[model samples]
Target: MFKNIISKQLYLLSYLIRWTLISIPVSVAIGSMVALFLWLLNWAIHFRFAHTWLLYLLPVAGVIIHLLYKLYGQSAERGNNLIIDEIHQPGAGVPKRMAPLILVTTVITHLFGGSAGREGTAVQIGGSIANLFGSWFKLNEADKKIILTAGVAAGFGAVFGTPLTGTIFALEVIAIGRIQYNALLPCLIAGLVGDVTVSAWGVHHTLYHIDVTDVSGQFYGKHLPVSFLLLAKVLIASALFGLTSMAFAKAVHQVKSIALKVIRINWLIPVCGGIIIILLTFLLGKPDYLGLGVDAGYPNAITIVSSFHQGGADFFSWLWKLIYTSVTLGTGFKGGEVTPLFYIGSTLGNTLAGILNAPVSLFAALGFIAVFAGATNTPLACTLMGIELFGGEYALFFAVACFTAYFFSGEGGIYAAQRVAAAKTDDNYLKKIFSKYRP
Candidate 1:
């Protein structure tokens, strides 16, 4: 028994030391690349703002993007899905070119005013880098998955400056209703190290705050300081947030299918998409929905941060962002859906708060993470994200909103490669209930 105990302790210590050493360099590589991408992305977005004529060249940009993929993209065109598929099955290695292909295409997408996010690009970079390193190290298949998870954790954490959320997200995003805890230590080490590496490079992430507190003057039970009525409001709003996520996912998927079918010429799909985006800009008489809503060229623009205040967003801001992002991404634009989801959620939360008579900032904060949680099926990570970005004052409310949104959001998500480890709701449960005795 003592010998067994000694052997176990030795094994555990070796495991810790091994992963720690491995995670640091992986984190540093991923973090450095992500920092570079963010810098280039910033310059691209600002340059487009300086010269709005680039918007007119969007069709040309789209053609270039399609051609780049057609000529050299190959498996790299799969983007994040390819990485996820590689994680699930370890053959057909992630190409070294994936890093540059996604990095360049994503910048081009944003530079030309295509509405998309950077998270997917960062993640692909991380995965590709990890895959490359895995090859050099000649690690076994199982070890490769662990290192890849760490890479994902590093990329997400470094990009957002939220290490804990990154760790959880890396674990939870692989499959719904399940998490790969075996990778926990490596992911945590990578996430923390990666975030530090980015900050070390002087890259700053967006700041968000929750300006209102909903603690009632009267306390409930022995320790509950929040009002039950406010919780009730959150429940209602979270359900709506879930439905909105479903709508966004379904809209993007259907639009992509329809556009691909209708435009048999292939590359013309994005061309038509670019033309439609131009028409929409004229139709709306504003360019507010053309890029990542984090920053706008025009004054008084509604953004994720702006939605935290009352009257900051139009009643239809959420809908417009959804439509804009759906069209941009569904028609072959290369970027992530997360930031647009953030814009949609916060704006929608702003509208709902007004109708619910709740605190605008609080609801917006909840919506920001809750909608992402619903869409990505990563409630725990989003709950931590709320704490990281805002504060822990509303942790309970954050969990409530995120988990409720998760259940209601269904199993479909932005990543088609994601598998359902467990169904959210067994569709045949009712049938089983009715025929239980017969069976």
Candidate 2:
């Protein structure tokens, strides 16, 4: 019995060792590609700003992007959703062309001042690279899934510089309220390697700070560490953040449907979107709602960093960002929604802190991760992200905001391919009622 047990343990160790080795190269490739993409993205943003007149050519750029995709994108146009679908149910596999198509088109979108993010583009690069590697090695279906998960981990980790969050996100993102432990080891290895590789390329992620000096208040004749009032405020703000996430998701889908219905020609959809964006920019009197919204290197510019201070963002800034991103992505622009979501959440949180009389930075930090958690249906991952980005000084509050946002955000998410493995809330009665009416 002892000899048999030892042999079984040795086989398991060998299996893990093999996968770990495979994940290293996969993650290194992903991280290197993401670094290159980020470098180009930064260049495009600066170039567009340098020549503000380029904004007027956005419609033309959109038309070109549309034609290019229609001609050669094929199933690659599905983007992150396609990767998610393959992970859930292995199919034709992620196309190799997806990486280049998304990279070039995303840069074009940013170059012309489109409101979008880079997560989707990086993820596509990672997934495409991993799938190609898997095919080269003739990996079976099960191993293919693990390889894809590792790719996602590498992409997310490298882009955002959060390996733990990236690992959990890759495992949790495929199914709502479910995690694939089978791929945990590979995902961890990939996330760590990817983050390290990106850093090795001299890339740096944005920094955020949260002040907790006044987070403590006396309560009920005892000196409590954290203020009860602050917790209450966090709960309320997180609920609003969740609702905003739902609104953004619904609006994106609705706008896409309306655009397709109104426009007979597919390519013209982005043209109209570009025109509308220009009009909105003129009306708003500033181009703050465009591009990544991380930083623009201009004083008093509304950005994720600016939203952490007082009087940095205006009321309804989040709403405007939601509209801009919805229209840009709805009209078939090539980019991700995460950076925009961060802008929306932080700005909205800044506004709420003014109303609630809470610490602006703390609330902004909470909204930053909570809204993403709600939108992506990955509360645990987002909670970890909060800790990674803002430190663990307010971990309990982070958990509260993230979990609450996840609950209130409803079933809709940015990734339609994500499956509902478990019901978030008890709906047995609703399910029974609907079942009785089924044909």
**For each candidate, what is the lDDT?**
0.90, 0.93
RMSD of candidate 1 to the truth, in angstroms, is: 2.2
Tens digits of per-residue lDDT for model 1, 1-439: 9999999999999999999988898889999999999999999999998999899988888889999989989899988888888878887878888888888988999999999998898888889888888888889999999888888899889888999999999999988888999999999999999899999999999999888675663554455667878989999999999989989999999999999889999999999989988889999988888788898687887888889988989999999999999998989988889899999999999999999999999999989999999999999999999999998888999999999999889889888888899888776986788787784
User: Taking the tens digit of each residue's C-alpha lDDT, what string does model 2 give over 26-87?
Assistant: 99999999999999999999888788888899899899999989999999999999999999
Clashing residue pairs in candidate 1 are none
Which portions of model 2 miss their true places by more than 4 Å?
A: 429-439
TM-score of each: 0.96, 0.97
Please report the TM-score between candidate 1 and the true structure: 0.96
For lDDT, the strongest prediction is 2
- TM-score attained by model 2: 0.97
